[model samples]
Target chain A: MENKTEYKPFEVDQHLTAHGNYWAGKAGSRFFTSLRDKKKLLGSPCKACNKVFWPPRSVCTFCFGELKDMVEIGPLGTVETFTLVTYSEPIQPRTAPFIYAVIRLDGADTGMAHFLDEVEIGKVHIGMRVQPVFAKDRKGNILDIQYFKPL
Target chain B: MATKDKEWISIPMTVDVPYRFAAGGYMTKCLTELRDNGKIFAVECPKCKRVQLPPRVVCAECHVKNEKWVELPHEGTLMNFTIMYLPLTDPTTGKPHEPPFVYGSVRLDGATSVLDHMVEVEPDMDKVWVGMRCRLVLRPKEERIGDLSDIRYIEPLPGQKKPQTKSR
Candidate 1:
């Protein structure tokens, strides 16, 4: 029955525009504001399991305990893993051939994804020491820290 | 418990997501024919014989395969219309189509479905009306990109005056 049926192919291209507003709730506001005002990185340490979250959460994933203790994590961190992006898109913060890395900051148990700058892509490797390069003009946002560079 | 005033802060952000969709077998056939040959094709249901535009594989109502193909004429009658005052987004380009434009659903000659598109007439009651005779105005062949936007806009057939309005 499938062999008897004939098929013809066609293509339709559609583009859509979407607009939305997002609020970085209670815990996230604290994490981002500290980065903006003091150029400090903060993490929420779970009292039960003792795991530190880089992008701090209000509740622990394992114990569901309220996480109130905020600790300063890293001015410097080690690159856990990274990739070099050669393609461009409308939403990308930087131009093509930029290095994006997962960095495990000093005194923190978790890693966060951010851009790595001031070094060749061929030179970036796991365990490379990197430090945050804070932007001159600060906003309570992730981009407040311009990028991490080899230290 | 001691009560303490807590300061809460909020931040603003924007996210843009892009996507691509594949027009499957039936629609591909209909759109290509419209693009290359300047002919509109529809699929007719095997059970109910209702011809659907942007041809589908199965009849939505009858649940039977739509195998027969029908070519519809370029001219159609304006079934309903609205003068948009809001800047509606054109999804394909993530841009807003300029406001205060005439948009209408047209039921083409010899087709059961209505094609909704921009109606290129003044946004006035005396100028545009229901049952207006309109024809598809396609983009030039060189500019045709095998998409719905290829049909530039629908315009009132030349020399046709608005129908006489009747009192309710």
Candidate 2:
């Protein structure tokens, strides 16, 4: 055995690159397209159970029935839960110490996760009323709405 | 049925996942030696005595703990190689290594396993061949970042000539 002098364990840092295409099925397409084009929120209501999904799903998980009803949800929502991110990473959507929130849009039963900005983290709380801040240069993407601000 | 324009759409998105992997006890020892000392280390299986690089805890064949550590030389024989034409993504940086480069595996002397790395030679059959003697070129001590990238590339030793071929 050679001289075993140094004995510190180290972490190997790496960033992986993956490329692929996603086929957002029927309900998903309508949901995303509305965000991109109309700056409106759409939800798919399950025909059998009447459970509405914010990020619309094609079928109801509970009853396993087709969700055919496309209802206009909210450009306004309430903060269901949130966390303050104090750590920064190169791949994050925003800088460190930003607030990420799960918001339940008006008339929708479920919540969607997105960044919360334009309000102090200290001022954010559960059930806080918020509205979407639409970006002027909109593409057909969820980022069409930059972030949610206090209503 | 609705018109084609009424159909659902897809938006292209890129998801980036970054990670930090902990080099375990044996690997930490091996990589640290490579980073600080510019030396290669291997663990020999107690039962079979087969030396494995990137030292592991147990040998697959012998099913015993590998205890003996051996220092391997910098020069090795090229076991196999490939002339890559595609811009292969290097997972370490999430960037593509520019294409049409040569890379290969070299079995170091007295070591059972081979190390795979970029081969610094023209992507030609006459230039690179199996069984060629190559030496590991590492980044200078200051520039060494304690990773496999410390090895800049493997280069063929000087004065090696291409084997003469008979015309068909």
Candidate 3:
């Protein structure tokens, strides 16, 4: 059907660059600092509930306790859940068809989400044993653990 | 075990948010006309007879359908102006327009509305003022794209000088 116009539609391309400064809180400060300096994975533990959350959070979800002390978590873990992203996005860390998985690290009570690699997309599944590959130039963020690979 | 010294860090990050816009029927006709023929078009309201540029489908004042098209002259009068001191990013191109530049609203000859555009003149007050005559400077025909960027900037018509201060 003719929309009946003298000219074709025009598409305009544009982008916005957003600048932000974020502070790592009391627990997160120590958590990220551990990753950048010592190449260590730290977990925040809630003593009342005995739950250690990896990708350390400031507060415990269930018991609502203040998680002050941090414990070193795993460089190795198991994939609890995962999905392969077939489409590309501007904000993704890698190219398309990469895997993002929820990993339950050894000695930690909860699952943390991160990128998974070094294995065939078809072969990856739940309970797959994996180990982290740390980035050489760590920026004191979760990206410090670049990705996880099959053990 | 007692924790060691506090090691807190604040991180600075830059993120890019991409965007795309579609120029609908009214603007599509106006922009394409500029790119292809170097002609400008404005929609005239049947009720109020207001010729608005960047042609709109509906009249802003009369609430009537804008059906009549009027051609606008590239020449116009500067209604108002400002000398910018901060480097504001041009959202269309994602680049800064560079500080201490001049831009203003120009009401083209025969058009009722004014279009805000970059004025290609020295930023000093002595070099520019309100009510100055200006003409649009567009990119070459071969380089013209069907967007507002097709018009490079506004150039003030020569021979006019800023008036001396009033004695009042």
Candidate 4:
């Protein structure tokens, strides 16, 4: 194929940088705090249907009721889907080809999303069992569980 | 009357902005290395046989992993190019890319695909065209960051003959 240099139009000059802070809301705080205790947590039940929500939503999806309190969940689950990631410069750790996945944790009705590590990409599957690997020192944070690995 | 006073009122100001990055995978490492070495790299998919420029971790078409790495030749033929007269914000650095500038996709000599970059060209509105040859200008290592800026811009390769366009 021949190389063609045709003048096309584009907006070539605008600029910006990392310009804000992330503030966790109430449900987010509680969700992470419970993870520090080594307890898998999900948002409150619907008084009507007894369903659990994760990422601890403010309201129930099934019954449409307000959610309150939190419930502890098990650590194991099956992999639903995943993709590989590569973190680079200015990206601390500089890790490339890192895998992240959506896991359907055991005992919890809904799945949680997090980084997947310590396994072969080909070995992983939709039904592969996996568990969260918490950091040695826990402070009740989502990062407390560094990532999930095949069990 | 008010113009004289307004001239003295001019002062420098800074503005803050928010941005999100979606970068991930081996492409990140490849770009980092390119900035570090003053070179560019690409990957070839064994399955579909399409050499992907700006190497990706997996083949989008083949659904297979790409593990081999090959260093690319710095020179290339300018594929599709453009000269933008309007200003736009730089996504990575959050600054404005200079106006009256050119950008294009260049097919590196060794790689199978073309990459987009700042193409060197005359600012005159009259004399730009297709099938131009360009060369890469790289930044020094110490000053380099693992970003596209590592290679300053693509300029006309030395001693290359200009193409004659057929008049329609």
Candidate 5:
């Protein structure tokens, strides 16, 4: 409180930056390496539950089965759902007036979330086939595959 | 693709989160004045009459609302200090101040609470001590935007030498 009851509002711009080294862990390391080096998508399968998760997890979400092995998924995928982001947020990977969609890559049972571009917002629809667009500067992160474009 | 599995990959991430906050009544008045006019103001408790820097709405000890604003002098005493050997990032600017530097709490004249800031001086032990007189240096008016950063640093006043002491 600056006063007993009243005061004018003033804004101060600041940043809370945290620099850290993240261990992508065994499962994430395998997934990211292939994605970054080979320009490929990988998914881990849960045999017990008959599910394959894209952005492969170390273990199955449905069952407690260990998913140590990764199989190549697709550069091609179908849009499961989509939305348009018109407002700005600090955490947003891209600026406002962009599209984000849930896409299920070929050979993967689960949907992976990523940005969608190279298509109009009005043209986007569920089950629309799309392809991954790789970045020129490939850092070993999810953003290495910049966005998904319409096939 | 066949590759080395001996060394598992780890991703290095630096999360830069932008933060914003609204400076309320007393703080807005205080910071705006300091930002625009280069004046430092604090609030005094009505009941106990203790003046506080970074002026607050209530005096916690007195249990009364603060109404009076007091202007403090740029000069004060170096009450406490430490020489940091680590290059630590300043949260306000998201940049690291080079290692081997000095910073301290300075109690400005007419203020009850001490203000903490970087002390501009050599990091050598022989140069700094408690009770050392210091003066607040502020950024030029054109550069100030009404935050605590307006006060650039605290520099030790001239001609003050550490008192001689006997060693055990």
Candidate 6:
């Protein structure tokens, strides 16, 4: 003998919570300021350890020391690694195929991740030279250079 | 990631994220103006002498407050792009924006910056290019808010093989 049971669809709200004031570092005014201008300024480079910092910071990630100045970066660079994104959740417009890659700029010691354009995924390599294309007017932001393209 | 089966059913739903977000003092006022005027805004740093498309309250370079508000040219290049197979749900509308949408970083022409948002286009991966020029399409006035989403998506620019800018 087997027992039969009814399934009920329950409505619920997922209350995801975190502790304390965790400010989104990316949403800060300084970020928007430079991003609007099209300037790609990374976190201050640690003069002692030589680590290229993004989101310009007060201290170095490597030596735990102060970062002195904003470092201008990436008019040209190389592709470090990449992947073709085939899937994402259906929330916005969906495009099945695109490539995302990590790029190491010419002067900086670190790699920045962004989209790779003007080339097929099959043709993308680990060491392709790319450049930043700024918008007509500089807003002083990172998105000013839309993406690194094959140069 | 998992594949669905005959026994599995897909349910569409909406999510809402509401919170008081912070902006720089000068930018806060400028963004408030753009939201009122149905325009998008960004800022430039005087110290580093770089521009930010989203606008800012403080200079990322000198770690000081940047008081200047600068309007950006709507035209720009599609620096980077991605096609999402997954639907990024609109917390406000409580629905997905629709499948096969393009999202990208548009470096606005005049400002030294870029804006990231959804794009309305065919999700053809090969068709997307880094240097592709794009123009901004602003949202209706009533829908305006001092937020990044105020200006809609960026469309391809006209008659330019490469983005219009001096080669750095």
Off by over 4 Å in 3: A1-5, A15-22, A47-50, A61-66, A84-90, A96-98, A117-125, A128-130, A133-137, A149-151, B1-7, B10-20, B94-99, B166-168
The TM-score each candidate achieves on chain A is 0.88, 0.86, 0.85, 0.73, 0.87, 0.70
lDDT of 6 by residue, B1-168 (tens): 433431221223345444544453455555666667655556667687677755666777689666555667777878888998787777644567777789998887766667787765668755566878788887887887555677777777655454355659
- Per-residue lDDT tens digits for candidate 2, residues A18-105, read 6677777788788777877788889988756767888888788788887777999998999999999999987787889899999999
lDDT of 6 by residue, A58-144 (tens): 667778886657666666888889988888755433365767778887667778787777888888999988876666675444455
Best by DockQ: 3
Q: Model 5, clash count?
A: 2
Find the 10 residues in a row with the least total lDDT in model 5 chain B.
B1-10
The docking category that best describes candidate 6 is incorrect
Between prediction 4 and prediction 6, the one with superior lDDT is: 4
lDDT for each residue of candidate 4 in A23-135, tens digit (9 for 90 to 100): 44556656666666546655554667766665667677877777766776657778888877765544433267778788877656677778889997888788888888888
Q: Compute the lDDT of residue A43 as modeled in candidate 6.
A: 45
Summarize candidate 1's per-residue lDDT along B1-168 as a digit string, tens digits: 422564345655565554566788777777777678777888888788888987888889999888888888999999999999999977667678898999999999888899999999988888888999999999988888778788999999989888786889
For each model in turn, which proportion of the native inter-chain contacts is also found? 0.47, 0.66, 0.83, 0.10, 0.85, 0.00
TM-score of each: 0.72, 0.73, 0.79, 0.46, 0.74, 0.43
lDDT (Cα) of model 3: 0.88
Question: How does residue B70 of candidate 2 score in lDDT?
Answer: 91
On residues A1-151, what C-alpha lDDT tens digit does candidate 3 reach at each position?
Answer: 1234457778777788789989887878888888899998889888888788877888899988877788998878999999999999877768898899999999899998899988988899999999999999998888889899999
lDDT of 2 at B55: 88
Each prediction's RMSD over C-alphas, in Å, is 5.4, 4.6, 4.3, 17.6, 4.7, 28.0
* All candidates: DockQ: 0.31, 0.43, 0.53, 0.05, 0.52, 0.01
The residue ranges of model 1 lying beyond 4 angstroms of the native Cα positions read A1-22, A76-103, A114-137, A143-151, B1-25, B93-96, B131-133, B139-143, B156-168
Q: What RMSD value applies to candidate 2? A: 4.6
Quick one: ranking by TM-score, best first? 3, 5, 2, 1, 4, 6
Report, for every candidate in turn, its global Cα lDDT versus the true structure: 0.85, 0.87, 0.88, 0.69, 0.88, 0.64
Docking class of 3: medium
